[model samples]
Target: MGTWSARPFGNDSAADWAYELDEASDWGVVSDALRVAAEAVPSDLDSDDAVTAIAAAEVVARGLGRVPESAGSVDAFVARVSAPPPEMVALAVSALAVAASAEGELADLWEGDPEWLAENEKLRSALTTE
Candidate 1:
């Protein structure tokens, strides 16, 4: 996982995903990642997928005008890309739910960590709120 913190983009997988996002010419990168995670059965979702999904959701959150303070590369990606379609916000919300579910590796990895859980909840709140 190579995690240094509980922030959405605080892991190696998410940092890699952020690089992909930065290089993308459109929002499809975010949409594809969110769709894959949103559609997967929680038990079948791996840690990398979960991490990427969370990072993608953070992008969607930014599109919805809720940028997190620690959005490193994501801030640049957002500035370069147009805001995602409204539907993507819904997908992001769903992806976040699945990624944080009890059956997923991400949840397992952060199981006993209050900071991780709070960070996940914070992302979720960002996506769902106006």
Candidate 2:
């Protein structure tokens, strides 16, 4: 996570702030970067593949932290993440959102991603059964 002062975004709701942030930015560049960086992620992600994707996503998320917390920043961050399947995308978004927060900035980002952990477990289990 990058540096962000403890300043309110002048909005009453955090969700609203995040929504506005997403709408204000040009996310194409970020999306391209994410897609290109995550190109190595296989369709059937093993643990390592999942780790790779998560790492790529984290880099993008962390980069976004440098910008002010606004709709544009959210848009840029979300756009850069190349997670497919609505579930994976949601997971990515949630994880990124948490990591982008003040508390998350001070904590280990991946360690807080329960969804990522669950997904990893699911993938690992599938690998063993197959």
Candidate 3:
């Protein structure tokens, strides 16, 4: 996974996904990532897809004015893409839940890492907050 930290964009997959996000002309990229993760069979979810979905959820949180202090590249993404629709917050939350669940590769990879789990919960909290 080439992960160096627990943050959403702290991995190779997420960094690559961030580049795609920067090149995207609209919000569809974000929605597509979230939708794909959210709709995946929990037992069959890929780690790359899970990572990208979490990154996409981070973008949605930023669009909703919930930008974290350590947003990194996601801040730049928010500046380029228009705000995500309000409905996306729910989708983002759903994606996070599925991606972080025990059924997915990401969850298995992060199995004993409390820091990774905490980071995932933080992103979910950002999306669910009013």
For this target, which candidate reaches the highest TM-score against the unseen true structure?
Answer: 1
- What would the per-residue lDDT of candidate 3 be over residues 58-113, giving only the tens digit for each residue? 88988888865435556776777778877788899998998888878888888769
Model 1's C-alpha root-mean-square deviation from the true structure amounts to: 1.3
Candidate with best lDDT: 1
Q: Who is ahead in lDDT, 1 or 3?
A: 1
What are the lDDT figures for the candidates, one per model?
0.85, 0.35, 0.85
Query: Model 1: residues >4 Å from true position, as ranges?
Result: none
Per-residue lDDT tens digits for candidate 1, residues 1-130, read 7999888888999988887866777889998999888999999999899999998998888776786454666777788788877788889999999988888888888876899888889899988777
Compose the digit string of candidate 2's lDDT tens values, residues 49-91: 2332333343333343422233454446556554233333334
Clashes of each: 0, 7, 0
Task: Please report how far candidate 3 places residue 6 from its true position, in Å.
Answer: 0.8
Quickly count the clashes in candidate 1.
0
Off by over 4 Å in 3: 69-73
Q: TM-score order of candidates, best first?
A: 1, 3, 2
Please state the error at residue 2 of candidate 3 in Å: 0.5
